[model samples]
Target chain A: MSRETILASIRAALPPGQALPELDNFGLHYDDPIQQFITTAEAVGANLQSVDNRGGIAAAVQAFLPGASSILSHVPEVPCKNFTRDADRDPHAYSDLDLIVVEGLIPVAENAAIWVPDSQYDDHAAMVLTQHQVIIVRASDLVDHMHQAYAKVAAAEVPRFGFFLSGPTKTADIEQSLVLGAQGTRSLLIIMIRDESTSTI
Target chain B: MIDHAQHARNFTANAERTAWHDDALWFVREKRDKATKLIPEWEELREQASQVKMHMLSRLDHYLEEFERNATARGIQVHWAEDADAHNRIVHAILERKGVKNIVKSKSMLTEECHLNPYLAERGMDVIDTDLGERIVQMRNEPPSHLVMPAIHIKKAEIGDLFHEQLGTDAGADDPKYLTEAARQHLRPKYLEADAGITGVNFAIADTGGIVVCTNEGNADLGTSLPPIQIHCMGMEKLLPRLEHLGVFTRLLARSATGQPITTFTSHFHGPKPGGEMHVVIVNNGRSAILAKPEFRRSLSCIRCAACLNTCPIYRRSGGYSYGSVVPGPIGSVLSPAMDLEKYAALPFASTLCGSCTDVCPVKIDLHDQLLAWRKYVVKEGYLDKGKARQMKMAGKLLSSPTLYRTASFLSKGMKLVPRVLLYNKKNKWGMERELPLPAKRRFRDLYRKRPRS
Candidate 1:
């Protein structure tokens, strides 16, 4: 078997063992994580908004993207035209999706990335296929850096699919000119909810 | 024979484009400096990352088995390839069994190394490269010049023309935003219609038996999410011992590659989506051989950030095509020679040994030192050119004897009286693009002997 052959080669080529360094307390940590998160989110071209409660999320989304027509909301606090979760439905049907609103599990302050596991939505394609995205993150769930973020991820049940999304899809392929919305979400809006509450609608 | 100097000469012939390319890459290197400065523990992070890789390399076999076991337990089919041909065949066999015709691939240097696109294309597969830069180069029938910015060599006007011809965009429309939107619209359908999605693994976690792929465009996410079959191709060195190691790499990768805090998306796949199938192909295409060499094995720690390429003066001024390899620049110069010493013997000499690539490397690979090491190996193996060997041999003999060196230094002063034509003739390769400094009126030894005591 090629597997055995490759393993034998790797074993034969092994060098003397070196100790793995301690990773604890080694990475960067921000003084004020929330503010740092806000600053980094904007730097990467993602819009940020703060809401007093979950009830206010829908209004904020409406105010920011009033022109969005085909919206899909995975969060119950924000209702949209499409809320169906049909496993049999083709993921290709979301190519025309204008907006997708899903709740973020954890937010990293250093890079302004939000961890969204598979449990957050029915179809993972909805997050990227849409023209715009609104990820709802709790203000208190913010961490200082990726090291802390991974600690939380490792402690939880491993999802089949999870991602750390920092900003909207972007590219600088042509002449290194920064262009937003290359092959995924063109615009991303992060709505941080400060208080938990039921949907107003 | 691949003469890197000759190819570099052809690239640098266009003085205007060369300057633009140099400035463009330097701008990225500057951004990297600024981004890394924001982290107070940047140096410490680099040290930790280096140690982690060295430790991983020492016990790579144990970790690979652990990763395969965990990945297999999660329902991901793990396959191993002895070389590039075996890798291509494994992927093709999977597609053939599934009757897959259309495929979408994101940025995968491994696939490029294996030349998988052409292999599948010859079998009548409609393979589409989804990354915007990759797509542009794919349409042009060209290889990526730089790893991070594949189409960096092509100007915006050229891209506008390419889009106009291939995707029916309006001619003379060179705005990056407009061109990028055209690509987004054009590729959305391909993602939807693709029978399989193929992506490159950024990091494979042994602890979780999952793979992490980072992308600025989220092309990998969309490409894999929509398709029923997803194939991830990874070089064996991509493995990490645990999940937390990702934090160390993710923090360094984007900040090093394009100066972002992180890529737009860092997607982790532990297993196939419900009712879907996933396969992981572990390739050993010349990597185990690299591991066998203790002096050069540290080069395996490269995270493909391309920081070394951006900082390399030779890579910036001469352009990536000069190296004539899948990867170009300082890291490529060291790695290519290992593949074939005869073919890539000229690569090590392409550098100025500036050590800037070493200073900026996140994993702390001694890139310039490796280049210097490769030069010795090349000479020892008798690959060094005869003319250069003769010149070095004479220089060695002169420097060994004090009387001969002093006498030669004294005679060199009379050469200044010679005409410019005599000094700058075809036989003087060093004088081709340079001028000799005026020889000192008196030898340094003579001047030192006449100096007053302090």
Candidate 2:
């Protein structure tokens, strides 16, 4: 079998096993994760908005994307034309979505990434198909770097597929010229809710 | 096939294009420098990443078994391939079982190394490259120039023309935004229609049995999520012992490759979603041979960030195609020689030994030192050019003897008076682009003897 052959080759080539290094402190920490996350997110080309309650998500989305019309979302308070959870539709049905608002489980400060799992949003196609994306995270869920983020996920029952969404999709393929919104969402609005008891909704 | 110097010479024939290419890569290098400077613990992070890879390499077998156990327990099929041919066959079998004719693939250099596209294409299958840069190069019928930025060598106008011809974009649309949107419209349907999706693993976490894929575009995620079958291909070296170690690598990969804080998407796949089948193909492909050699073994730690390519002076001017390898740069110079010593004997000599590639490597591969070592190995294997070997031997003998060296120096000084005809011809390869230096009249030994004692 190829498996046995490959494993034998690896065993023959490998040296004796060595102890793994300590990696808990590999990531950098910030004095204020929220401020740092906001600064880093904006630097990576994401518009930021802050709110105190869940109701403010609608206001923030409207303010961020005033011209948005074809909205599809799963967040309870966000305004949308269609809810992906309402029906058993194909992922491609939301191909022309103008805006998608989903809740992020955790906010990482080092790179401004927010963890969004498949369980949080059933139709992940909305994350990539929409013209604009808004990911809401509780301020209390913010961490300093990826180390803490991974620790949290490992501690919790993270689903089969989870992704860290940092900013809007971008590309620089044309002579290294920076261009946002190549194939995915063009604009990203990261909203941080200050309320401590912000539900998964 | 082993004429790297001649290839580089032809590449630099267009002086304007050479300068532009050099400046373009330098711009990327500068961006990397700026981004790295932002993180105060960047060096420490690189060292930590290196140590993590070192530990994984030593215990690779154990981790592979562990990963396979967990992955299989989660209903994920894990296939092992001893070489490129086996890897292609495994992928083909999986696709053939599903009767998949069309596939959407994200950027995976491993697949390129395996020649999977053509292997499937010859069998009447269509492999659609989904990454914007990869799609651009695929349409042009060329291999990727840069690892992260696949179409970096092509001009915007060329891409515009290609898209206009193939994707029906406006003929004069050279704008990057317009071209990207055109590709999006073209690929959206293909993503949904593809029977399976193939992606390369950035890091295979043993603890979680998860493969992490980082892409600025959500192409990998979109392809995998939409398809019923997800086939992830990875080299044996792409493993980390723990899930927490991902923080260290994720911080360094994007910043080193494209100066971004992070890619827009860093997705982790532990297993297939509901009703979906996930297949993980682990490929050796000469990685075991590389691992056995102590000097070149550090190369296995590479994360495919292509930071070395951006920092390499030789790579910028000569272009990626000049190296005649799928991966073409300082790392390529070291890697290609190991893969085919006789065919790629000239690659190790393509570099200037500037050590810039070594400095920028996220995993600290010791690239320049490896290049020098490959040169020594190539010569030891009797692959050196006959004339160059003779010149080096003669110089070595004369330099070992003071009298003979002085005589040779004296003769060289007198040869300045010889006609330019003898020195400027094609036989004198050194004089083709550079003039020979005028020899000094007096030797350093002679001048020192005549000087007054201090």
Candidate 3:
């Protein structure tokens, strides 16, 4: 079915009021909220310029796409995953412009290191990320964040320890005391872009 | 009973616990990928397993009958439950016959679906969950957020607290190893003393008239091996045509569900350990309803692999409990509404329709598309609120014609003050969070006109 019909059918299928409070207009997302919520949340604010990695939105974003890896990171170490310009990406979903930057390009300074949960390989990505703000999220930490982000938005409210994931990480080798974030990034990094655009001030 | 909105709020909170939850599960997902990548037949395996499930779903009633017949010949008593209440009572009645007040249960989503423990508790029976994760959640007085990993939402520190309070651990003793030993010591006695064991069927073989239970920790083995009376609760959809399908399914099941090369254990029980009593309850709460409809028939194809749950973006953000169903996440979003639309109507809309769940599913349930179809059913039932219905009808009328749509757009964008009251309908989700952005002066088509075509 067409996106409109799929949405119409879904909207039609909802038991009314249950579709509670949706984006004013549904475009490509099939009127699904999870996408709208996450991608939009990720959109945060665009850089005033083209810079997506560091400088300005214009220069940064441009450097990150279309033979993105071909454009070297301002930081030398962080490995840049090949970037593709996904113009069709839903604003509510993670954009196609994911750049797996080298881990060590910018290291977490002593004071701010506390906030960022460490990434799995600290020493390897360490050199490239020192100057830049870094979030060392582990596989487990990402899961926790996803849980927290969904809960944070959906409830239209937030709760403490809201992002902790409980189950899959728990091992019953001896007895099953579930440990979350054990094998993952324990801290998150909020990289402060020098040239602000849409990001929180 | 909570309102759908409140339950939805709770679900959102629970589901958020899963956003990273999906990412976390992705390791296992990645692991499955790593394993699948090595083999050229990975996609083929998914197809064969899906077809097996398709055949089973189509003739669920028939295979179930065959299972009952074979199991009965093997000296097992079979019961059927039409709903949760019936399912619970069947177990209760069996326990009452055995005069057992306590029982051990191994990882059964069906029991969770039935709410068996709480139901039995009210009737004076103490139902103990034997699966390690289930045990932890039960001790904490919380529902299992994820089916396979019962205590996934619980942290080790929190578990330390739970164990400290219940099992007498030192305060702040948060070692996973130490805590597990404590639980093992605690549950061992319960395993030996329990009168009956309840296990969920991972796969039930119709030909052998046997039931299979898969687990990593071997909790199900202890539950069934020790208990004199074993009660296996299975959904009608858990059947496989022949026993050989086990090799393919067993290969994919754990790998897909938990990223393990194989679940630590896969045990098949023909019926009663020689002399013990065996009972199988094939519950069909809403399978028939879904099967009757073509769009949703494929949902029954799910192997409960949870690959969809692990990969779903919405499920990742929101943990399972937010769903307010025995099973949560993408699978529950579709099935819950199918089982009870009034109760779960909001679920389908909870998704962004990313199609990730469909992609990860080994059985290929077409979850996103079914959700799209279900949306039509919910609306066609006229269950919509009149005011919103009127609003939608008005919007529909305007959008049906381009000229009217343009006029409405121009007025909203150009007028600036169309009365937030009128332009920003507070009752809508748009107004609930942020005001809708006014339209740009020109449309994309107009912009295309300005710039030469590529």
Give the whole-model CA lDDT for all candidates, comma-separated: 0.91, 0.88, 0.58
> What stretches of model 3 exceed 4 Å from their correct place?
A1-201, B1-32, B385-391, B409-425, B431-442, B447-454
iRMSD, all candidates: 0.7, 1.3, 20.1
In the predicted model 2, the residue pairs found to clash are none
Give lDDT tens digits, candidate 3, residues A1-201.
Answer: 122332233233222121111111111122333233223222221111212333233343343343442221323334444422233322212212233222211111100111111122222112111112222212111211122222222343211101111111124322232322111111112333433243321
DockQ of each: 0.89, 0.75, 0.02
Identify the superior model by TM-score, candidate 1 or candidate 2: 1
Candidate 1 C-alpha lDDT tens digits along B229-300: 999999999999999888899999999998999999999999998889999999999999999998999999
Give the DockQ ranking, best first.
Answer: 1, 2, 3
Lowest summed lDDT over 10 consecutive residues: which window, candidate 3 chain B? B1-10
> Residues B49-162, candidate 3, lDDT per residue (tens digit)?
777777666555556767777778877788877767788988899999889988888888888888899998998988888767788889878888776777766667888898
lDDT of 2 by residue, B2-90 (tens): 68888888989999999989999999999999999988899998999998999999989989998898888888999999989999999
Cα lDDT tens digits for candidate 1, A1-201? 999999999999999999988886564567788899999999999999998888778888998789887888887766677546565678888887899988899999999999999898888988888899999998788989999999899999889999999999899998888988888898999998766453232
Q: Which residue pairs clash in candidate 1?
A: none
lDDT of 1: 0.91
Top-down TM-score ranking: 1, 2, 3
